[model samples]
Target: MTQAPKADSAALSTDTANADGTADSGAETGTAAPPRPTPIRGYFERPLFDAEAIRGLQRVGVIDVGSNSVRMVVFDGAARSPAYFYNEKLLCGLGRGLAETGLLNPEGRVRALNAINRFSILAEEMDLTSLTMVATAAVREATDGEAFKTEVEMATGIEMRIIDGEEEARLSAQGVLLGWPGARGLVCDIGGSSMELGEVADNTVGRRATSPLGPFRLQQIKGGKKGLKNHIRETLTELRDKVGGDHKALYLVGGSWRALARLDMERRGYPLTVLHEYEMTPKSIRKTIDWLQDQDLSKLRNRTGTSAERMSLVPLATVVLRQLLHVFRPKRVYVSSYGIREGILFEQMPDDLRACDPLIEASRHLEEASARTPGFGRKLFDFLMPLYRNAPPDRMRLIRAACLLHDVNWRAHPDYRSESCFDTATRANLGGMDHKSRVYLGLALMNRYKNPGSNSRLTPLLSLLDPEDIRHANMLGRAMRFGAMLSVKGPNAAAEMRYYPKKEVLELILDPDRQALFGEVAQQRFSALAKSLGVSTKLRVARTAKLEVAKAELANGEAAKAETSS
Candidate 1:
């Protein structure tokens, strides 16, 4: 775990360093220098949002003034996967009595104001130029909403934008898209006083509809359980007709939905607790809804670590979700941890940033921040491309992500590094990945350190992938294990690999000058990789210049005639 040496900043800027550590300076030679060779970009290096476009968003603060809670989230770090630099929520229940009385709850208003004031002060201390604040449902519908808005402006010097239900729905769907750029289907966001539905497809939000179907509002309805069920059914029926029912997946947003998902996970003893991409089938949802009817909510809350405030709303949300499932009849359901706060950030992003894959971008950011050699992941992916030349686009993205994240846990103790990598791949706040992909990536990373047959404790999770997936994961891990051994600089600096699947041969051609670098450990790992590929291995040594010439000749459809030594 040695640290890479810091480059001389002056030399790094003024002249390019040759492989032999000599400076290439045109002024010293009295002739123009050759153009620098452009580094090969990996599949994950597709065009991203201009760094300058989001420079100011590095430390953005967003306040979501919802009916049930006032939450302030200060996003920092990578724009695509912005870390929660600061996050705090105060349950104000601002829409508690709004259904009975067309006014904001007096007690809830005070709490909401104090919460906003506290967030404003915190933002000032954090040196944020301004905070993006938006209020949903309750505030927009309450009669005194205007007065509260003015009071908030006067007290905290923050102008709160009270968005209509349609806009709120749109933003919530965008937040889903922020985490799942290719997400298509319906987004259902349930707050305290209102529930909004937005349709999404092709990375854009379509029609949106909102209803007074929130728990707080449902509680005020004259009907008991039976009456509430009827109202929910009718409301969702209308919403389905308005928003269309062709959605394949339903993305649940907001606290109550998350609480329901958590309860569902607890009921099923789900292994991976990360909720962003937690999936539930329609049958499972119905069963969980039925299962909730028999359980003691207080005990369930404790077991699932749900707050009393949020858990109290779960029953009403459950009714809505049950009906939502019935009306939409989606093929799948997923819980999205992202909501209006993340949506606010998504709204500010340029189109290019919106288009970037959240998972790959986040992985790239992790590599840049944590890997010993920041850019080695790209080289590793390129080095391994031959093994996966025929892989579909979807699987290729996961392979690319695995390579980028393969070495980020290098500082962990040897005994726990594999487990740590597995945990990170499964539980880290990575977006755009489903549960199965999480396990696949985890298995690959685990294999990066330890060989196969060592993940006994991870057997339950391993069930997520099939035999072919397991084999592919092992091959990826073994390839990385071999490639990482070649050079601390990177695999490309020491050798290049060629894999012939049909012929069952895996060849490693080493740089003649660096052949000594392929010691015992490297050979053993190379043999393991070959074994994983079920191929025979060949080792060759060629001069660096001759290797380059051979590569060019091969590219030009000419036979390479390099001098090789076994």
Candidate 2:
């Protein structure tokens, strides 16, 4: 759950104290020097207070407890994608004897407990902002569920939830949907304890069902075919009727089945294999399932696909995969590289925030709008930031991405742009969204400029979304429009756009009798937005002693190319 034992440890070479927390980095500070990473002068509660100090970013760790195994993931703060820095999984089958027995065995419980303890220590030492731990079917169904949870929390200081079956299915689908673009079909999450079947249509989720035959349960049923076969048959019969014929394109998740597929591919020496984009035909899948069915537990242990700890659960996993294939008869099975961890990320977000796809619905809309007006979208966003003095720093970046993509609709046909842009962003495979949620985002984008009597195709779309998201789309849309109007001549064709704030009215130092051509309409729109958005709009043109703009290297950015070469 934790990333590392140490924080800060900035790759800095020197340090110096100031009246504020800002420090100069060097071997000498023109005075006696302290260590490089020490808190600066006059800073109380250095980590939390220090008004002028460098604030640290927060990280969240997501842990998943499954029937076959448990895993932990840490997303790094510094990386561009906030890439994964630590990922570890252990297979401790509390579910192994669960079919015959009602609870976890003594040995299995000890092993699982030890793993949780280690994770807890790491989380503490690494200083994770928070950790979300969820126990799935194995632990949920165990008679000693509450006791097991108590032991984990007491031992590791990490509280866990034994989430219900419906919650599990919803989260599993959400996690997969977070990074899945244009994914509309069924999600079949086959775990050690149960099979969760869900649907993502137009980015909305409906009909979540958790089937009885988990890998462990199915294996037991297969082992005692004459006795437990009817149970397995009945479960599959119910699942087939629920899935019906049309929604059989499967988005496969959970470890047992993924491990099986990975092992089969590794054995066959298929060089190109990436789990998220991993593909397999029904024929290939059937052959792999058959091979797995033929093997005994010992053979499975010796096989390449089996992890050291998951050796015992092979019999159960194979049976579940075979039974599902036989009963549901899906056309294709697509492997998912994400599940509960991602779902937990979605859960942590505010409820209204979850109604739409965050990245796709928001970021794409603004980026496209900037492209149309040949405006300084980024600069305009920076200028407008004074309005968000109390907003979270992270939200600042989100607002920026939204502004950049605001004009994406301009690329499509003008009349249907709002609707089309809404559709494109949600369904275009943008990261961090499902199809229906993406639809909601698209709808929000189209309705950003909602006006009276301008609610035909857009009204039904708006009905499916959260009201706040619609408001956000408008705020973002206004900023984009303001930025565009500033470019009256269109993309440097001429300098018709002029900016002058009411507080600092235009004062030219040109010839006393001369006046430059400044468009009145553009100026009026600029003033309106400045008042509306509460931004200080500024522009000045005067004869100065210096004739050309200077090129200087910035503290963070490099100098202009002409200056660099010189």
Q: Pick the candidate with the highest TM-score.
A: 1
How many steric overlaps are in each model, in order? 0, 21
> What lDDT is reached at residue 41 by model 2?
24
In candidate 1, which residue pairs get closer than 3 Å at backbone N, Cα or C atoms, i.e. clash? none
lDDT of 2 by residue, 1-566 (tens): 43322221120101100000000011100121111111122111111211122123356676677787777776543111123556777777777778788887667688888887887777777788657677888898888877999998787766687877777777777665544433566777777778787776544456677876776766556547555656766787787676564664566776665666665565455432234434455667667767766657565556554566555555566656666667767666666666666665544433333333334233433343346642234445544454455655334444554445556656677777666765554444344332223433454355433321355544543443356655555555554454454433321222212334444432222211122333575566555545544555655543332211211112122234235335
Candidate models: Cα lDDT each: 0.76, 0.52
Off by over 4 Å in 2: 1-57, 77-82, 222-230, 243-245, 266-269, 291-305, 309-316, 349-566
Question: What CA RMSD would you report for each candidate?
Answer: 12.9, 18.7
lDDT of 1 at 32: 19
Write candidate 1's Cα lDDT for 1-566 as tens digits. Answer: 11111221111122100000000000101121111111124344433432655665556677788898998888773377556778899999999989889999999999999999888888888876336777888899999999999999888777678877887887788777777666678888889998888887767788888999989999987678899889889888889899998988788888888788888788887766677767787888789999999999999988888899999898888888888888889877877888777776675666666667676777887887799877678778878888899997667888888999998999999988998999889888776777777888989999999864744788777766778988988888888888877887667667788888889999988987778999999999999999988899998997778778745643443122122111
